[model samples]
Target: MKEKLLTKEDLAEDHKKAVRGNTKTTREDWLAEAQRVLIEEGVDRVKVDRLANKLNVTRGGFYWFFKNRQDLLDILLANWKDSKNDPLTHTLKGKNKTPLDPLVRFIFTTIRERSYSPALDSAMRDWARTSNKTRRAVDLVDNRRISVLAKVYQGLGYEEEEAFIRARIQYFHQVGYYAMGVHESHEQRLHYLPIYFKQLTGFDLPKEALQGFMEE
Candidate 1:
């Protein structure tokens, strides 16, 4: 007997169901899984087959969204780069805010609360040790992030040299904290936060704001 062949419509339906079924394997899902694997098990574990197995889907689903593993890596690098220009930038550059307001908001929203990925941060920095492309991407993000923080300091009326120094201090401290794997308890850190803020910004974080942070 002649075998039945699937038409274009039938194949399209299968594709749709493949995406919407238990797997829901889309481009973002692949990238997110790659990031998770990169963070948890280093970049070596972020393979297409590994992610396909993790997602309970076929490697063909990966190719449906990515040309290859390198393509996924490129997307991951782009995401890390874009993270530098996050909502904190808008808070820093907004109107009607005190100089300290921007500083406090940037610290509370970005660093303390961790608006970006520390695991991916460490992973990318580690990846940078070998790959020139990864190094350049990491450097670009670092420069832009520090530049924004410096501008916030400059807006606070600090001299150019002072602003730059303060920016590096704030930015590098968080990087080092994650890079070195510091183990301070959250409550202890919160208790010391006002002191750190005073030194970092040369002023106190208001009682009300500190209270609000604890509430969060």
Candidate 2:
């Protein structure tokens, strides 16, 4: 007998079976996929079935890690609020650093490394429009971030109220920069860094501040 050729349906069924048999999928795997979906599409599209399809695993695997879809969503929101993983928080925690190091590192991480994802931030903000709980979470995160930025200004000798206002200006400017969907190349943004620094901080960006970034 001639060897039988598998049809497309057969191949798909085989794939389903293979995924169903998979036991290696972890909670982090599911969350990562959900986060990607949340950023690329929207929160509404972050369904369990949809994520299982993207991850090439059975939906059963998801239940092993989460109680339900809401559980996953709650975890996602919690992860966003976790300051230990936040780049801005991490940058501010540096020891024996210059007064301006936090600001410089904040700019570098946000622009160069993209550790603070604008797309993810925009997605969470969009989600906030529909969910009051998410709105509160976003508000909390925003306030915390702004407070950290304010301290950077305070370290530079600005008074409390002035530091708060300046921090809002700097933080809101970056948030709006992404929200407005402004397109600028890395080099173009880099070229404007000193000007933006001066405008936001009321002090010229020192040449040495651009030290490590320029060589990269």
Candidate 3:
């Protein structure tokens, strides 16, 4: 016996073993892990090595998905601005039979379903403090969200200035609620939903809306 060569089947079996030892992680998986670290440990700790360890994968996998840590950070910001904010914009843009229908749906999305993440929002805001690029992105998101909200109020028959003011008030109130770390149980928030609705939108929480929240 002078030498031995592996056949295709042998190579395939070796590939399977390699896969078992270190599963291939997708680009989305890396982004999600980076975001989790960004939210939990802050931007400083969202390093490639740190994320690799947390994801239980090699650092090389991250480079396969992202050019560098900065590229991943930029994509994370984009995803948050576009995807994370979709529910809010979608709720407002919906063509409900009544203006209040959109308002009701908006309340449900933000409060009941929690399609937005307060922790992620806070983390981004914290990151903004140190990065001008992040600060601009955050400002753009805030303005866009408020602008859409003002349009919703305008559809409800408010004047331009009043609609803008009301939008700011509602947006500021929710942001501050999270910023201040106000602890309220689900039931407590539900209890105050009607009051908040009235104060924010100048419309009574429809009995049906309240019923829907309770049922949900």
The regions of model 3 sitting more than 4 angstroms off are 1-22, 83-85
Per-residue C-alpha lDDT of model 2 across residues 108-145, encoded as one tens digit per residue: 77887567777888999999999999999999989999
lDDT of residue 214 for candidate 3: 88
Residue 119 error for model 2, in Å?
A: 1.2
- In what order do the candidates fall by TM-score, top score first? 2, 3, 1
Clashing pairs in 1: none
User: Which candidate, 1 or 3, would have the higher TM-score against the true structure?
Assistant: 3
lDDT of 3 at 97: 79
For model 1, what is the error of residue 195's alpha carbon versus the real structure, in angstroms, after optimal superposition?
A: 0.9
Tens digits of lDDT, candidate 1, 110-211: 456566457777899999988899999989878877888898889888999899999999889878978898888878788888998988888888887788
Q: Each model's C-alpha lDDT?
A: 0.76, 0.83, 0.81
Model 1: lDDT to the true structure:
0.76
Tens-place lDDT digits, model 3, residues 1-216: 221344556545543443224566678888988899999989998887777677676565565566678899999999888834567777878778788888888878778547767788899999999999999988988888899899889999999999999999998997898899899999999989999999999999899878967896
Q: Among all windows of ten consecutive residues in candidate 2, which has the lowest summed lDDT?
A: 1-10
Q: Total clashes, candidate 1? A: 0
Error of 2 at 123 (Å): 0.9
